[model samples]
Target: MNSNKDIWVFGDYRNYFQNRVTLQILARAVDLFSTTGSSVCAVVFGRDVDEYVAEYIAHGAQKVYVMDDPALNTYSIETYSWLMSHLVKLYKPETLLVGATRFGQEIAPRVAKKLKTGLTADCIDLELDEKGRLVQIAPSFGGNLIAKIITPVQRPQMATIRPGTFQELPHDYDAKGEVICLPVPEDLPKDAIRLITSERRPSEKQKIEDADIVICGGRGMGSKGKFKKLFELAELMNAEVGATRPVVYSEWASHDSLVGQAGKNIKPKILLSFGISGAIQHTSALMGADFIIAVNKNPNATMMKMADLAIVADANQMCLGIIKAIKEKIRT
Candidate 1:
């Protein structure tokens, strides 16, 4: 278990390329492990998964183990857990990283339990301790403190990283690596649950993380009535509405609409934050935004400092004014 050590980044694949989270993990693992004399390998599963091996290689993985199986195409807890557990037993990787999606969260714990290992989920930062062990850093106590968790004795230190927590490596078409095709193990169990139908909602109403434009509200919005103005402005702009932790805890918005270190990372084309003070816990995830416009009454707010445009004004009146002006323009 100790001699053949390597970093294994689970390449969570969607309909298109490997999910962005996997690449982010790969980029990070490559940066840390390559110098420590550990190779980076991507473990990908799906029907025809080999097609993605080269793409992963370009993103800095030295090797890829592709599990191409019809049964593994869609996410099945039973199938994924068994295969990964078997692989870990055979190879005994030093580190196993999974993207913290609903699928990763489900399968990671199962696989870790099977291997008698420890797992740290939703980590915001990562570091290598002096012992060369992985350090999993995440928010704690309502983002007041940063907690570092490590599995000191575990052979394969496992963790699930939040999406948008890190940047992706630039693709290098000329880069090359080894690709291994894995066959479906004979004893893998069949999935009891099945997916029947699916639908894609319009971006305006889609998940906040996937939205192109995001309008976020904070505690300074004052009350529920005032917070509702964010939605009105969002409707006019065809954007998604997001909230800071305080706003969500106040029941002004749903948990899915929350953004930041503990919630979700958002990198929209346009990010308009209203009344947000912009703590590091909240601002860390907004790294992907192309244009940031932060509105807060306090000129010294962190959000204002990070924003391309900072407005020292009342958020409610500004939102109402924008909505009214947009409506008037539409009439013309």
Candidate 2:
């Protein structure tokens, strides 16, 4: 094993804090690279971001590399990619794990091309194989087959990792780690996609990924009018609403609310599905749910067979019944 072969983590920021996805990626990296005596180095860049260094260290990075400068204040693909490429050439890391976020997805490929290395995107699983090579597992061929990708010849095997694919490491308040501030590359072009103005979108109170109880619909939901029932159900239980790919494609739900191989992987405490036929693409994402309760008209549906509790009935009628019963109970 190469001693210089370190695991570099891209600590992507959101709302002035380290994104949960970045912490999730570093946690897995720390576990895998620790066996090889490889340093888990987290790279964070922003203006006045000294606050995040300790948090990253608490999440399992042995070394937190900070590049705090006004020039790195706002995120730009051009500047970030050039700087990341510089770090790779200078430090010669063995593996680089990036959060497969909107920002990360756009930047990872650019940096990979700059460094002339292979990059695997949106990996659901990552492990070091018997040969000490990085193995990236992800879905391929329209979510029909699982593909294992490896970069044997690339110096640093790079991967863009999805959140909720792995559990985050617990914070060790008593743990002590190093924080080394790295100087920003001076050669970065100033004219690289200059930002004129920016506006922030209002945040949602709830999202499927963060919900403890999620109620998702599928093609069997029948129509958009019926699809609104999921919202009423969610309100009754204070649960978040998710949907299968078909439901999302049909515009019954937004893409962010989609739970499947092609969408978000949610690990709710209670995952309740209605009228879902249990396609493999949809079922795979529910592996992390604590409890799965399925209701479908068809008793032989795949989701029903795999559910912890399967109710054979009319999904719409059942949903209305539950809502009615709850309201009546409240009145009493």
Candidate 3:
């Protein structure tokens, strides 16, 4: 509880398999150890969380601080905030990292407020300054510009990183780490909000982040009618459909399918862009695409310039042609 210079990551494993943000942050924290010279640690609060502790070690955590108790069986924002803030005070860690998931968004700010520290939210990248201070990079002015922030005055610099921003380290079963169990304070106060019941409602739609191939459409597709054809193409090619903000706002696509700074970041192996102008907000999220094929009438469009293969043509016509080609290939 007294390691003042260690980098700490909060373990969020509720959607352990589906949501890998916690592990991703842990990997990034581990990378920082070389520059910051701080031990990479994870703090987990849950019941029967030995598996998660071990997983953290395999994923690059040098040590883990666990608070295992029946009281932590369910997540309570107030209770979690109080406990996390208390832990920060006790440990005095130099930096704390949390995933920018909904759960993290709710708890991180409260803990920062309690400890009188600054927190940067939804950071796209993290690095150390010349003085070894944490530099948090995120979008500003509605994704028009990027900002690098540092909590120079705070003891525990805090930040919530966007999901899919970084890749997790591969599991190493032979990795060694120390696990120190911490006792939950007996004087913990009752939470103001209580969870009466919980239910699981999983989405059947493919998450764009997990997609190997992505078919992305933009407002240049003209109307909702033309935009809907991307789904057919996606199905034919076994790809996920992504949309630019303008297309989503025009009701041509659902918000869930949006790819932008405000939406989900995707790192698809292959990305096919249709009629997109490549606004930075949309382009920034797909920077990790391994191969890009862009179809647009304007050869000078940003998307076309960024593509590995740019085709100058009507997006709708190209989409229909690709679909036809796929069907013919399947029949043969």
Candidate 4:
């Protein structure tokens, strides 16, 4: 086994262009390298995936290991877990980071079990401890409190990080890195199940995490009828709608639009918060918003304090006024 420690990021290229979680995790691994003095590497398995390897290098990977074979063309949890466990045994990486996508959530735990190492899921942040162990920060007790956890005796500590938690580094065309091509192992396991065919449906709207402008509503919107106005405002402003947990539970919004520690993390350029009291669970997720405009009846609400511009007024009245103003502007 190699004596030097390495930080490995799983390269998920199924939606390379649209899903940027892999690049974001690679950027975070590079940042950790400064602290651990470990080599930053990416591992990928897919056919015709050379472009993704180059992209990873451009984004700060010091080295890339690729197994580009036709047999590995599509994603198979069985094949992936087997291959990943094999690689870890050979290279002995100190830490492994995977994106908390559906694919990753399935494969990471399997690999961790095969290696008998601890695995943390849906981590919001990661930092190294004084002993150089990876400290995983995740929500606990239904998102009320934050928990920091560590694996005391596990090799290649593993964690699945939420998407949008970290930003990716800028692409550098001039950057160079080593690419190690590996042949498929002769004993690669056959998948228990075979894929026949797959179909992808087009998305009808933008995901809340990727929105440039977000209009968020809380319980103070009074009633579901009043909350519906946020959708009107969103359409007029060309923005996406987000909701607090209480609003979602009240059936005013879908779970997809829920934003908080237990839900999606958004970093829109501009965020408009209405009637939210600024619970820690909700505010922590939107900390990355470039600018915030908050409206609430209580001037001392936590949300109001955190906003760049705070308005003390009835949320429904303010929402109606904004909608009317926008309509008049459109007429002129």
lDDT of 3 by residue, 183-264 (tens): 9998899877878986432233678899999999998888888888788778667689999999889978888889989998
Write candidate 2's Cα lDDT for 24-49 as tens digits. Answer: 88888888878887899899888887
- Give the Å shift of residue 21 in candidate 4: 0.8
Per-residue lDDT over 229-320 for candidate 1, one digit per residue giving the tens place of the 0 to 100 score: 78767766879998999998998887878898989999899999999999888998899999999889998999999899999999888888
Off by over 4 Å in 2: 1-3, 16-18, 204-332
The runs of at least 3 residues in candidate 3 whose Cα sits more than 4 Å from the true structure, single-residue gaps closed, are: 1-3, 204-332
Measure candidate 3: CA RMSD: 14.6
Residue 57, model 3, lDDT: 92
lDDT of 3 at 304: 94
Residue 27 CA displacement from its true place in model 1, Å: 0.5
Give the TM-score of each candidate: 0.60, 0.61, 0.61, 0.61
Candidate 4: TM-score?
0.61
Higher-lDDT candidate among 1 and 2?
A: 1
Give the worst 10-residue stretch by lDDT in candidate 1.
197-206
Worst 10 residues of 2 by lDDT: 198-207
Instruction: Please list the C-alpha lDDT of all candidates, in the order they appear.
Output: 0.84, 0.82, 0.88, 0.89
